[model samples]
Target: MQKSILWVFIALLAVSCNQTTKKEGLTTEADKTEKIVTATINELLASPADYQDKEVAISGMVSHVCRHGGQKCFLVAEDGETQIRIVPGGEIDEFKVEMEGSTIAFKGIFRVLNAEQTEEHVEDHESKEHHDVEQSHSTAEKAEYFVEAIEFKDITP
Candidate 1:
């Protein structure tokens, strides 16, 4: 009877070991592939080699959502070197609701550059300056989520 129990335990251990090996192999294969979606700031930064000097896509909450110049606003979060900038325009009310200390989600191409290429100029690693919503915005177009081909969606929970 003891021998049978020992055999069962050994079988279980072997099965678990095999599963672990399979999981490790899958993770190894994933390291060679490209990732597009980032759930958090840490995960995004973990793979900087893929977006050191390129554009990538990501989504996250608007940690620092503030409007500048009265009309334009930017969401600031740690996106692999403050490269995460998005100004949501569509669904204004919904977006506002999110900006009110709520969670928001944005889906846009990230320009993971050391410098940001603005509409007419390039700003490099600025310390996240926010504008006044009522004073900075004039046209509905300013509500856009991106400046030079960047955009986002509201993420509410």
Candidate 2:
């Protein structure tokens, strides 16, 4: 009986060691990947150039997702005023309309638009918005920040 008990203890110890080794391997791989800087919608908007072309992780509530194709979505900060446009990668394919209003954290590269690009984006966006809504948007309002999302998953509880 004592021998059996000793063997069981040894088995448990071996199993624990194996699990720890696996976890350590996963951590190493993750550490090797590029680090994601966390920022809010307001921070990104405050200085779009600072975060532009840099990989980052941002958290915000999904205010709107374009119905035209689901390629675009807008994330609104807690203030409910500031927003950043997100263009999901091919991996994402599309975003569901139901995702609107849900908070999510996503990894992506913040993109900056020059005056020319901004003007084009605004024009495209206006074509999709309601006539009344489009009339209210100023040139400044149309040229907000943008993000190219590589990965996204619901973070809301």
Candidate 3:
């Protein structure tokens, strides 16, 4: 009976040690260890190729979130000429519409759209009106690079 009690105590202690404590903000040990390169949304878009396939960090105000489920988010800077799509992964589950206008810092790897994705993006744009069609064509020309986020934390004031 004493041995059973001792074993239960050991098991409880092991579980507690493995558990992760949630802090007010989402800052993991991995985030701290990564080479987080802080840049604005515009900077990233301006030199997408330079940051391609490399881990980068960017901070921007969220302009939109996927209405259906918040699986994706659009980040924009002051210039607003370009935007970066944030594909939430790892610790990030979804982005809420309420998060709009809130500043967020994201750490992730940048990737460029493949030929198939570019074709599909253009096709989607072609479905809209003539003006939107032209804009979509331009978006297609831009290569549609995006970031695959591993971590994101709100920095709204």
Candidate 4:
């Protein structure tokens, strides 16, 4: 009986020490140590190649907000002509967010989609009505996406 109790305690200790490793998935540590960069949305969109696979610390006005299934909040930040997506998750804060021009600055992993493969250029003015401007949306995109919670940094022009 004494040996069995000792073995159970050893098993518990081993289980506590042996933490699982994730090759690809969401993790608490992943949310903690993400990289951060600071740049305007226009700069990011203008030369999407510059900040690719880099975390961004961005500040802009909140343009739009949409909650899909109440799990995550997706919003858009607009600076003149450029816009960036703001995706926030978890119990962030109990603050009201009025979009359509509210200043905000946040840090997250920034991803710029490939424009050449998915987007097309339009040069004709008349054809502009019927032409579909290219949109930067693609899979395998590494961008300014942050997991877990994000703090409300500050407002900017």
Candidate 5:
């Protein structure tokens, strides 16, 4: 009877240790996948290539949200003049018009268009009748760099 009780205790200890190790492994994996770099809009625009295809966290004041189906939005940098475009991705269907004029923080991947893609984007922008007059965000709207946002939060006060 005594030996049986000792063996049972040993088995329980081993099982508990194994469960703890598994939980630790899961936490480690989550840490690796959640790694993200934070940056400002101006910094991102200045060296877009450095952050290309990398997950980044950025915050800015939402300057505009496309009136057409909210397919896209623009964020003004701390400089107050420079802007960068953000498109929904990773389960996000679209941006909301109410986001305009609010400060928002976004996490996503930075993408840059190739030469041909940039030219096409520019042409498309120029074709828009509403763009007949220049605007502060016009440069960013027609530029090759933009962010594909996976998550966002309104931090406006």
Candidate 6:
């Protein structure tokens, strides 16, 4: 009877340990699946290479939105001078003019145009008649770095 009881106790202990290990494994898997990267606009701009093509979350104040067809928008960093361009993607159709001056949080892929692409973009911008005058966001408008936003939310206070 004593030997039998000892065997039962050992089996129960093994089962409990196995269950704990499984739970821990599940937690680890959950962590791995929830890998959302939230970053500041400045940080993303500082190292565009690090974030290229990667999905990231960033927030900033909307400094400008293209009035032509609302195809694009610019977000100013905390420094107020620095800005980055954001183009709609995913299910988004356009950025409304009302969004300007509102703080918005955006989730998207950080994209960097290659040298050839950048040259083409600059040429295209210069060709536009409306671009003759340099605006505050002119630099960012022609920057190689921009975000292709998939989702965004206004967080203005």
Candidate 2 or 5, higher TM-score?
Answer: 5
Off by over 4 Å in 1: 1-39, 52-57, 69-84, 87-98, 115-151
Q: Is candidate 2 or candidate 5 better by lDDT?
A: 5
10 residues in a row with least lDDT, candidate 5: 125-134
Residue 87 shift from truth in candidate 4, angstroms? 2.4
Candidate 6: tens digits of C-alpha lDDT, residues 36-153: 5798889988888998998889999999999989989999998889999999997689999999999999988899999999999989878875566788999999999999987899
Question: lDDT score, residue 97, model 4?
Answer: 49
lDDT of each: 0.43, 0.77, 0.72, 0.49, 0.89, 0.90
Tens-place lDDT per residue, model 4, 11-111, is: 98877666433322445666677767777766766676677767776676654443232222333435354455555533354234454356766665555
lDDT tens readout by residue for model 3, 1-157? 9999999999998877666454423466565677766777677778878787888888878877766577767777667656677877776788789988889888888877878987796676456432433431244233578788887789998
lDDT of 1 at 7: 100
Candidate 1 per-residue C-alpha lDDT over 1-157 given as tens digits, one digit per residue, 9 for 90 to 100: 9999999999999999999999778757754774555444344445645444333455545444343422333444444223244443323322343364444555434333333333222221122332334321222123212422133445666
- Least lDDT summed over 10 consecutive residues: which range in candidate 6? 27-36
What shift in Å separates residue 95 of candidate 2 from its native position after superposition? Answer: 1.0
Task: For model 1, give the RMSD to the true fold.
Answer: 15.8
TM-score of 6: 0.77
Q: Give the root-mean-square deviation of each candidate in angstroms.
A: 15.8, 10.4, 6.5, 10.3, 10.6, 13.9
Estimated TM-score per prediction?
0.36, 0.70, 0.66, 0.44, 0.77, 0.77
